[model samples]
Target: MNNSLQDTLALVGRILLAWLFVPAGFGKIAGFSGAVGYATSVGLPLPEVGVAVGLLIELVGGLMLLVGFMTRPAAVLLAFFTLVASFFFHAYWSLPADQAMMQQLMFNKNIAISGGLLAFAAFGAGRWSLDAKRQRV
Candidate 1:
């Protein structure tokens, strides 16, 4: 594809992907205790600390991805986070008989999101990104 088309696609992908995390982070922030409880239920070591760190990564990293600032690094971090979440929280590999259909759906979605983040890491922020401007200087 031409440069302009590539740039537009990248920007749209970044926005859509980043928006996915923003509400999640905001939900954690809005329901701090519920987030803590959920984290604990998931057997996350140091539930409070994990929730804090996860929220920051989701919120700040999502914003950075959206703006294309530090896009490559942000994408890498988010991708890693997605992988971990998929395995641990989403239980992508575990086919528990008791798991609800929604749980299975979440697992698949997390895996897909991880793939998208990996794509961003590989293809980069494209022409319209702050990273591009920085690269030119």
Candidate 2:
């Protein structure tokens, strides 16, 4: 209803979404070998490169989102990344019964996250963002 509230929501939303990826990126890099191994297990070709690209996208794109800089592009990139990850790595349908439930949950969660990213891309970062500041100048 109000600009202030709208801006606050945008900033908080950005922070909330960014947290999901920031620690994950840090952890992936911190345990680089483990991430690569997991990627390999998922049958991604060039697992090392995949892990590196994922780490870069999560870390850099996530930070850009947090600061509301390049917000639309960053959100779109992450959204695409999430969709691919959900289908490829978290494909619950291909798993055994016991593992299927967990994978399915993860897959669903990723899909929901992608929806949020898409919304952000449509709305643009609100007035609290660097994008907004640049617009004023």
Clashing pairs in 2: none
Point out the worst 10-residue segment of candidate 2 by lDDT.
Answer: 82-91
Candidate 1 per-residue lDDT over residues 1-137, each given as its tens digit: 99999999999999999998878889889998999998888788898998888899899999999999998889999988877776668663455667756677888888888889988988899989999989999
Tell me the tens digit of each residue's lDDT in model 2 across 1-137.
89999999999999999999888889888999999998889898899998899999999989989999999999999999999988879989999999999999999999999999999999999999998898999
- Cα lDDT, model 1, residue 2: 94
RMSD (Cα, Å) of candidate 1? Answer: 1.7
Best by TM-score: 2
What TM-score would every model get versus the actual structure?
Answer: 0.91, 0.97
lDDT of 1: 0.87
Query: What are the lDDT figures for the candidates, one per model?
Result: 0.87, 0.93
